[model samples]
Target: MDPISLILGAILVGAAKGSGDVASGAVVDAYNGFREALRRRLAGRKPAQTAVEEYTADPDNWRPALETYLQQADAQKDEELLASASAVLSAADPDGASHGKYAVQIYGAQGVQVGDRNIQTNNYRSGP
Candidate 1:
């Protein structure tokens, strides 16, 4: 997945968990912070604000709107927003269901490893 989708997925998962009793303490706090960050980023836009409201009310059905809102807000480029969303996801799903239980999405990546205990060393040098 692209960064945009990755972050959006995290936000959605966090939202789902946060709305339920499963979320408490740190999870709730992180989820709230993520929502607040999104709200601040989308302020002064009635449609965006409406999308957020709708998403909060019905996360399952309002995802497309929130996704659009995120795109309009340029969420992918906002490291702070990304971090906030990631925090919520981490707090809500500590086992990293963020990438799916056993799935990972990697694109244009190098020397990436998963599902194993391994060591890697990189000696990258670029020249003509």
Candidate 2:
């Protein structure tokens, strides 16, 4: 959905991968690159750095603070950081579509769209 949510999800995924005992070198490298990029972006901002560290520990609890800082830093617009985060997510979840954890049910919907970067131009015209 939103950029902050995307970044937070990437962070959580990277953290999970790093915590695993059998993580691949590529995954680890990608996670490290993402973290480093974030760290660099939040270099002089103590609160932002703290938010990141705290959010890693308790994501749900620290989400707002972390989100605020991330927005303040314009992290979504940071190409390097976004690329690094994408790398971590790609390395951790190569499927790029589903990780065997989704159950979506849409009912009575028109022009329904799922996932990101989507463009759905719907035109309903009266005809016979």
Candidate 3:
């Protein structure tokens, strides 16, 4: 999966977990992988690492921190970290929906708003 897609998927999963949406053990393991990847990226950065741990422990409460870190990475253009995070996140999304199979394909003349969430698409051929 692409970096952006993977990151977004990770955020989605994290958000779902925060909202008490628990999946199979594999999903949790994947989430852990995502957390470990974040930890590794922020290694030696106490504040960042702490934030990650907080999110890992209480994803719902600390989800904002994860978003902050992801935004920070984007602002800083941390390609390597983004790539690494994406890979980890993609692995975690067992359904492989994070591969951008149909992401961001706005069609026709309709308006769409995805307020504070992520949307994945597949073969979006038209709009009304």
Q: What is the C-alpha lDDT of each candidate?
A: 0.69, 0.77, 0.53
Tens digit of lDDT per residue, candidate 1, span 1-128? 34555556556666677767666788788878887877778888888778766765686678678778778788778877777776776777678645563345687887664433435687778898
lDDT value, candidate 3, whole model = 0.53
Q: Write the per-residue lDDT of candidate 2 for residues 1-128, one digit (tens) a residue.
A: 34566578678878888657798888899998899999898889999998887888898789889989999999979989887876777778778626621123456777775544445689998899
Lowest summed-lDDT stretch of 10 residues in model 1?
Answer: 111-120
For residue 89, model 2's alpha carbon misses the true position, in angstroms, by 0.7
Error of 1 at 122 (Å): 36
Task: Show model 1 residue runs off by greater than 4 Å.
Answer: 19-22, 56-61, 97-128
Per-candidate clash tally? 0, 0, 1
lDDT of 1 at 3: 50
**Model 1 vs. true fold: TM:** 0.63
Selected candidate, larger lDDT, 1 vs 3: 1
TM-score of each: 0.63, 0.72, 0.44
If the candidates were sorted by their TM-score against the true structure, best first, what order would they fall in?
A: 2, 1, 3
